[model samples]
Target: MSLQIEMDDPARPDVLALLEEHLRNMHELSPPESVHALDVSRLKTPDITFWSVREGGLLLGCGALRQLSPEHGEIKSMRTPAALRRRGAGRAVLEHILVEAKRRAYTRLSLETGTPAAFDAARRLYESVGFRECGPFGDYRLDPYSVFMTLDLRPQTE
Candidate 1:
């Protein structure tokens, strides 16, 4: 399938529905206090750039990058529709987010995800893309149910 990823309006009804499903799943998988997924309204902020992946008009997945600083960004709200999981839609969205982060000159990218079994695949996906486990970042604090990961975007010294 030819997947196309592009910046999307969080207010779109279909996009809102997907985000709502993501939020619902996060709440179900983690404790209320540990759930960090943003709702559609929060994702509409200027600091966040959201994207949707579509194939022939079918929404495949979505993700967002929140600028934490001039040199850093946070990955947020990554979700693939149930029917599209394991089909590379999530990976496409993630790689797209990474490209955007680099384009914005962010030196590092980080994310907070759950520690539950439901998140194993997601964690693996992040690791596959070079994201390593990290400490709480941005406004986050250490929490038992949360797993924080980060990818360094700076070029390695020779």
Candidate 2:
């Protein structure tokens, strides 16, 4: 499949629809108080960089990276439509975000996902990329419904 991913504006109609669906899914998987997915307005903030994955002019998936500090970033709003799952769209978007995080000199990248069975695939994706379980980061606090994961972007040393 020919996939093209680029930095995008979250306010675009297509992107807004995808993000709205993402928020709905997040709320479905976790309680409202535990749901942290950003809405269109939050995604458009200066500290957040958004990207959309497309194939042949159709949106495949989207993700965002929010800078938490000079050396740290948070993965946010990663979602591929149900019909688009298992097609590498999610991984492509994630890898693109990881590359951008490193390009921006971020030393660590973290994400918060739900602990429900509906999120098992997402957890596996993050694990496959070397993101291990971690405690809450940024302004997040401990929560039973949330699973936090992080990856260190520093070069490995022998």
lDDT string, candidate 1, 1-158, tens digits: 69999999987888888988888898898889888899888999999999998999888889999999999999998999886777788999999999989999999999999998989999999999999999999889999999999999998899
**What local lDDT does model 2 show for residue 38?**
87
Name the regions of candidate 1 deviating beyond 4 angstroms. none
Question: Which candidate number maximizes lDDT?
Answer: 2
TM-score of each: 0.97, 0.97
Q: List all candidate RMSDs to the true structure.
A: 0.9, 0.9
Residue range 1-158, candidate 2, lDDT tens digits: 68999999988888888888888888877889999998888888999989999998789999999999999999999998877788889999999999999999999999999999999999999999999999999899999999999999999999
At residue 104, candidate 1 shows an lDDT of: 93
Return the TM-score for candidate 1, rounded to 2 decimals: 0.97
